[model samples]
Target: MALFLLAFFRRYLLLVLSFLCQVYVLLIRGTPIVVQVMFIYFALPLLANIRIDGLTAAIFTLMINSGAYISEIVRGALQSVPKGLKEAGEAMGLPFYKILRHIIGPVAFRRMIPAMGNQCIISLKDSSLFIVIGVAELTRQGQEIIANNFRSVEIWGAVAVIYLILTGLIALTLKLIEHRMRIV
Candidate 1:
């Protein structure tokens, strides 16, 4: 969410602030978050003397990875706002920031709902990848339970249902938001 706000700030308020953001997005999107997590958790200690635990590394790596994608979604949505409204806002003696806050932000955010909501679901699914780093996430727990009880059918079924519920909630919530934001 903060990254989404920063994306808007960079696009309209301060161009220079966006350079580093763009590089961060490029680097994160260029590589798999798994590899990024591995680098942070393992390579960083050997090369830069920065060592974080698996969970911390995984969380931060996922955050940066997701932030990069979310920023793009936000930027695209913000850019889709019409140029005329900005000019009008300027004619009304409004600063760019105020125009964005009162005008562009709401419209862009409404447009952002569908894409951003999909990203939320993607983030949830992607978190399962952290199991490779020994995060003991839902999938890992399912694996452990199956190994112990040989109930793969039931355990996996339950896990699948839980994930479905989560993604469903995200979709439903976003739909509600979109409905509420309708220009009444």
Candidate 2:
């Protein structure tokens, strides 16, 4: 599965990209998400000859955005894995990769859950910014409906409620994952 490879690749990528992650977070966190969205949607097309649809552009932008934050969460989790555990695993003659796979990763991942959950919620909300690029996500779809009907108050209110429900569902799903992982 793609997810399996993604997880494996992400684990090693976090180690390799730790410093880059720090820079990305520092640079982007100083700027507004709107600015980032605008640059991706507007500036890139001007500089390059390529043209992408709004939805594709949105996905690309959000992946870059989320990756920076997620990498830091991963790096911190990797660092938080006790040095003693690695040493003990070494003492048991486990290979470095085996130690990482069998010992350090599982514990670090459990501790990383809450931070990753927060990142997931952020990514979900950040998807809303795609509307500025004319991506017909929930917000953009709602905006089109409101624009046609001229029911600003009710339509936008419903949009906000829908966002709230979507966020709540994300939180609940993360909680369930945390619970199940904890039980194991």
Candidate 3:
């Protein structure tokens, strides 16, 4: 089915995008995320005569930002996959794409799940930085609540708890996948 094919190639496409994101990371990692958000939200409007909404800008910035780190994780996992597996796939007369799909990708992906999970958690936390650009994510929402109710301690604490819950869920999901993919 078309859906299965799409799912199958998603990783490869993500891998390529992740590589590009890695390059972005190498360039911007030293800069603060606040600066990055400001550049997209403030500088772009002034320089390019463009205006993008907070949520869209935040998602774009975070995707590329997180992509950079995720890409490095992906590259390492790809490299860690055993070379013998590729040879075995080829020996079975599998084509390059087939070999990658059936062997290289699955093996590398399973090994990379933990790192990927780490990246996801990092990304979710980084979403808080979007508050600088006025996006209404959890952090921004908390800020608004505090601004209205003057309950900085309680609201911010609740926001932190929400992020912890989200990250914990991500960790559990990755653990399940890692268990399912264990080599035995």
Candidate 4:
């Protein structure tokens, strides 16, 4: 939704909104996601005096962090849509939102598939990072088992394999969807 608004009104709202959007993207992409998570989970409560649980913090952190990058991908895709299509839509007396919903969105989303797939893979793997904040994710669970059983190599190996399987499944699923959605 943020990306949609930004891309749709970017020209009309270019001056203030564009700068704000750029700033948001810069801040999100500049810092490591781990740091972002840490800040939200720890520093936010300290500064705001509002207590949020680790899970909530982690979800918010990941959502905002991923949202920034995804917005950029979507923004680029929206821009890459051909001007002729927009012109044609206008010629047919279609409204802007109709053109966007029926034409630009579908085409640009198709273009965004590969990049979106990668981001999904990254997010899945990154969930492990929440272990640092004691969020009890897959990596954290693996670590606990290793600590109890003293099977570091086996546990870590299994964890790695699980992650690999997850990413593979994500890639496979995306490929299937891409094939189905392909223009050919």
Candidate 5:
């Protein structure tokens, strides 16, 4: 949704809408994800009069938080595509969608892979923050097991390994994709 909004903003930027997007990005990026989770889990129910479970709140907060950063990544990637290529497409009488699909999209997607991968890893780590709102995330589950068994070193060490494995897999996958998609 944020990507779609960014595409629209890029193509036909309206002043008011542009300002709103900037404000949205600024607000989300300015605050901590934990605070966002707490707001969604605790305050939203009172303010909006809607019941929300911890998992639901966590998911919503992460989506909102990550969307803001991802949109910026996309915006930068799209802008980084050479203007000359776009102009060349225009000279060939390609429509905007055609130019975007056939020319700009591929280049921008290739350039954005590393940044997007980084964002994914960050978002994965950020999920631990949801534990603060009583969501039974990996960290929370680890904490529970430690509380019962009092094996802090072993349990915490296992949790660290799990996180490292997950993040490593994400990086490896992105690197493979980026290598395969490299311009030849």
Candidate 6:
């Protein structure tokens, strides 16, 4: 959702909105995810005078962080759609929206698949950073078990295997989608 909104803003919205989107992308991409998680989990409540739980803060932080990167993925994918396609659509008397819907969108969507897959995996791993704010995610759970049982090697190995399996599944799913959507 954020990716679509930011891409739309950058592509078709007012100049100010486009500029703001760029600034947002720059800020988010430049900062560390850990700091973003900490700031959202700790500093935001103080600044906004609203209370939020660690889980809520963690979700919001990951959303904002991943949205910034995914917006860039979206932008790049859209731009990668060949200029000839748009020109051909115009040559056929198609409107901008129809051109995008029928020609550009599908091609760009296919291009986006791999990068989106990578971003999904990165976001999954990054969620472990929420441990700083006491979100009891998989990594945090593993750490807790290790602390209790003194089985660091086994616990951490299991956590690593779980993450690997999850990421592998994501990659396989995306690859299948990309194969089906191939432009052949």
Number of the predicted model whose TM-score against the real structure is largest = 6
* Global lDDT of each candidate: 0.88, 0.78, 0.76, 0.87, 0.90, 0.93
Model 1, runs deviating above 4 Å: 13-16
* TM-score for predicted model 4 compared with the true structure: 0.93
Q: In model 6, what is the error at residue 10, expressed in angstroms?
A: 1.2
Looking at model 1, report the run of 10 residues with the lowest lDDT sum.
Answer: 6-15
Candidate 6 lDDT over 1-184, as tens digits, reads 6679799788778999999999999999999988998888778889999999989989999999999999999989889989999999999999999998899999999999999999999999999989999999999999999989999999999999999999999999999999999967
Candidate 3 lDDT, tens digit per residue, 17-61? 545544555776667777777788778888989888888788877
Give per-candidate clash totals: 0, 0, 2, 0, 0, 0
- lDDT at residue 165 of model 3 (Cα atoms): 91
Cα shift from native, residue 39, model 6 (Å): 1.2
Top of the candidates by lDDT = 6
Would you estimate the TM-scores of all the predictions?
Answer: 0.93, 0.83, 0.80, 0.93, 0.96, 0.97
List candidate 4 stretches off by more than 4 Å. 6-14
Residue pairs that clash (backbone atoms under 3 angstroms), model 6: none
- Candidate 1, 74-139: lDDT as tens digits: 999899999998998999999888998898888899998999999999989988889888998899
Instruction: Order the candidate numbers by lDDT, best to worst.
Output: 6, 5, 1, 4, 2, 3
lDDT of 5 by residue, 1-184 (tens): 6675664585458888877888888999999998898898999999999999999999999899988888888888888899998999999999988998899989989998999999999999999988888899899999999999999999999999999999999999999999999988
Flag the better candidate by lDDT, 4 or 5.
Answer: 5
